[model samples]
Target: MKRKRVVCGFGLGLLLLGTGYVSAQSPNIVIIYADDLGYGEVKALNPERCKLETPAIDSLARDGMVFTDGHSSSAVCTPSRYSMLTGRYSWRSKLQKGVLNPWGENLLNPERITMPELVRTKGYLTAAIGKWHLGWDWQKRDGSYVFDEPVRGGPVDHGYDYYFGPDVPDFPPFAWIENDRLTAMPTENSKPDPRGGRGGPLVPGWDPEAMLSTMAGKAADYFDERASDKNPFFLYFGLTSPHTPIVPSKAWQGKSGMGAYCDFVLETDHTVGQVLQALEKSGLDQNTLVFFSSDNGCSSGPSKSIKLAKELGHYTSGKLRGHKGSNFEGGTRVPFIVRWPGVVPAGSVCDQMVCQIDYMATVADVLGIEMPASAGVDSISFLPLLKEPQAAPPRETLILHNYYGEFALRDGPYKLILAPGNGQGFGGGPSDAEAIQRGDPMVQLYNLGDDVAETTNLANIHPERVQLMTEKLVSSVARGRTTPGKPLRNDAEIDLYKKHLHKGK
Candidate 1:
């Protein structure tokens, strides 16, 4: 597959500058976000433990920079999405735990400065295609759910020029939404799903089988349309596959010898390949900055059971500790790959601590734009590390969030968990009560540099370190913003270390 490369013919001029300033030409930005994808799922990231193949995603790592310590702000999809777009911690909002229901109100306030909104300021076209788990303003006709009526507070309302795909995969109203309107009115109720959440008011022919393929084709079409456009475009392609309902298309079924889950993961990789090929075919590859990452860790759903994965000799979390919905490294740590011709170095690996929330600031840094203090309060630009892999990480302290109240704070290599538990929502982990009854420390601590799997607890031995981290977490919460600035007010009262310990005791 030959690709048309674009050269600005200023290589010598750029070399003379000495400073690594980004080119004045606005580059196309494409973000491919996967749902519930584990760090170990990418073969390049987990060469020794990952049995499933992922050539498309691995190719990005080969041609670009791979961050070994990249993470999402939360262990679930909704909050992570919120943090990625708004550059603020989801915990700062009222949604302290769990994801939003499909019919619920939109959590992304319209007033906030979203990633797309910021990009649009530079006159770029923005589009969001695929699963939008974030809530929207649903329409009702005569007190009954109306499908064709425009839904507010969605992609369009949040700054996307175009919006397409299902609102949520396993949630109600399993039908496609083009812009603010549904393609077809959902008239039939879906059968109850025991393993995954059931869909509501689905259209008669809603098939999970064709969902991913259709979305991929639409994304390809989007690239084709924007190929010759005057302004650079930004496409947020959120993939829903390999998350739940574990339905691998016929072409990918049994492709991976592991199981249905592995097969679905392969299909996801294939989808990424298709999108990349589309960009190349449309002559948009060279001027595009491609980013690939997951919303969170691999889900420990029934279809992707831990026992079954272990039996198949596959470790979804690789050498990390927990799965999705936990505060452990495995739950929040994810695969991050970025490629930009003549900008990012090829085959470079960065061990910098970064989070999805930093996307806004990094984008601003790339464009040489300064963000207001009120926006992206928790975001720190990793742009320097991207240009110089040996440069130290911009962010030194990070806070990890879970659906439960168990929060972990990381300062350099040491991490302090406010509570004791696996931080998972399911599949055989100690409950808070169980940990307390077993004489487990009210708090847990570990040095991730020495123990990536979080096997050792150094809280009892290093009370001073634990106390210091606990105080930092408290100060961060009270200040309402992680980055330097005037302390902002949280949307609601936050649950911090002291409160958690008092309740546990």
Candidate 2:
């Protein structure tokens, strides 16, 4: 372990050169992004309340920093994944709402550079395992998933040396890909998820049951193989479990007693343990930067909504007003746990509002690499905050976007929503009723510091503040960029999204 920890010789020399920018002892970066885990889902975050055990995740938080107000760029998978990888807002692209279908053309533009690409330029073997919700072109000719469609715009095209998992569950050719080649060919084209297996159909050649374990095994293997390797690695392990189909392995079944949803979460927690175990076993734990977070809030399921309501008498979105798919605090706010051994303080909690979108520039900054103007437009380097929670975020105003491009920009205590409809979506029960009074207009405003649930609409009283944030959201949309860095391409991909997206359907 001692030999594995390379001493950092921090010098301007690495920074002066265009490539290897991070410290010589640059830690391997691993981002474990859960699909729909909620803000207060982790037991440590809400010890007195949260029902989910997640000891593995709890141990992870104890090892490093835990963020209270972390959010995904988008509430849903595709958009959120797109924003995380590109460091740009999904609204900047054409896919305005919901998510992409498995059969749809890819969402990422082939020409646009990505985070893995940025890091790879500085000598990192970037690999993305597990679920890839961002769209990818697969299987069009002679049973070949590639099909001359030019798998150019995705992680492979960007910077990752390897790729895996379904282009999302329901998407066609539902199988893992190793460097653009499918591990199992879609001998039969998968159909729109018919009845159940969580969300996607139990398609041929695709056993959703084994996916969680399979992915974890592969990740562990990858880490073991890379332990002795010289070049630092950036691995993005995006898990599909705890997302949908709610199917956990038989051993994990009934363990949660909250039904499939909680069972799947337990399975996800085990997967986290597997990852951390691999790092420790390989002597890579100390030098590896491990981050665990979710793309969005918890999904509305029998466990969290019905079963939990019957038993706990409430939902798992915790104190948040709504669940996944809404702009409410639950939808976008998520758990963010980062572990970097000695660099980050253990058991520390940071209340700063940060998003996965900042990772592009933040990782680059930590690595000491110069981000080309073409990359990381919306990404602010949160490198300083990683080691020091008191350090200010690079950006004062952090934005939260719902599934349908409903925008919420937060500047300190004040948060301004661009549109109406309660910002929680048109729904039933208490939340929607409160929204009715506002009539869903005039750019509702609230002091998140005061009203975390956003119960009071201060729009009438805070007109000037509303106007300012509205303008900011509109201007950001107009610019079609998110980060403050330069556009990766002087000529941004005119075709930001692929045709045949779910919208067309």
Candidate 3:
């Protein structure tokens, strides 16, 4: 296919030189974020190995640009969401460990310049449609439960004009919220959900199976509402499926022969199709810049069913090692596809190492807005890669954080994991005896270009390289931001080296 470098059509105006300014209106932006969807799960990315079929997602790759080496900022949800929206690493903040609990305190600091706020500055209408798991300040009903007092310090406070979704489907009040208040107050207690983790403040007859479809329907409705509006829209549609509460709706029950997990993934794809179809019906597809990606790699399947999934020929992580919460590619690597008719070339593959944190700068570049020194400090725009597939990535050094918030730095193909431990927690990687027998070192290092699976550790083989990367990681942490500008103070002390060394002891 012939590639196009020109950025025109879809109402994008004149690109002024030097000064970040656009003469005309910007395009509509829609980001479809998947929860726990793996790089291998999408058939187009892993054609030879992927077992489950993801036609809707695959179509996005076929019709747009597919990033072969895209990643989330962290291995888990809250941090990933934080970095993606704020364009700064979550480790720079106080959340260095596991995700937030339901109705937990907001992770987004009040002063941060979020992605939505940047887009809104370009005269766009911003809306967060699903899974606002980054945390919220809720009014408590005494000390044990939460009341429906408008959720303060949430998406609305951060940047979004509207917000709707379950706070965290996996760990939740078992209800949906629109803007700040619950769509319907919880009138009954929810039994332990069969899908996965479940908790109280449940609405009467709330069905986990209906959540995805409901969110999809709401998004479609929103599209309909905006069909006639002249202003551009930015929809951050966060899908909460293929994560836990693995309830594949009745329509998708027996779709994927692999298992319930596969079925849920198919349903997730179906929801994507619904949103795309809505855009098409609204005549918005021609001008919309749609991005499809996952929060992180797949987690261990329900009740350790990942082994069963492998037996059924479905490798969720593809050739990558470890699952979510590890320091391996399978933990942070995720599928990223961008579809913008006319502008982004169809069926192009870019192998640059792009991080979700870069979304802020990418949008800023698209809108021709200058990002302040304090904002998006870690973001490096991959916007050039969108126009030219062979363009060099804006970033060279990429950081990966494990579930425990341990750090790893990747420079070129070589990656240096700062501390000793297997990628997966709970001693999940090869047994220590096996690793010792294979001569794995205290700190792990691998050339991901040659060893995508991360099986071989070369820490002891190249001491100088390890020392250099370790120093870089340490400097990045202390500097407060990775991109240029004077260093800022971190919210709290970040000592990932200590955390990784003492973890799983």
TM-score of each: 0.94, 0.86, 0.93
Per-residue lDDT of 30-98 in model 2, one digit per residue for the tens? 999988887656787766567778889989888778877888887778888888898877766767667
- Global lDDT of each candidate: 0.82, 0.70, 0.81
Tell how far residue 252 is off in model 1, in angstroms.
Answer: 1.5
Better of 1 and 3 by lDDT: 1
Model 3 RMSD in Å is 2.8
Clashes of 1: 2
Off by over 4 Å in 3: 1-24, 303-305, 308-310, 423-439, 499-505
Query: Of 2 and 3, which scores higher on lDDT?
Result: 3
For model 3, residues 1-505, the per-residue Cα lDDT tens digits are: 2333333332254465353334344678999999988888888887767777788888898889888789998888889999999999998888877788766888888988999998887778889988888887876566756655677887889899998888788776788888888888787876677778676768887878988889888888888877767778899999998889889988898888767888988999999999898889888888788999998888875624367455766678888887777778888889988888776778778888898888888888878888888999999888878877777768889998887667889898899886666533531465333444555576889999999988778888999999999888888888989988999999998886753244332
For model 2 the local lDDT of residue 261 reads 75
Compute the lDDT of residue 226 as modeled in candidate 2: 90
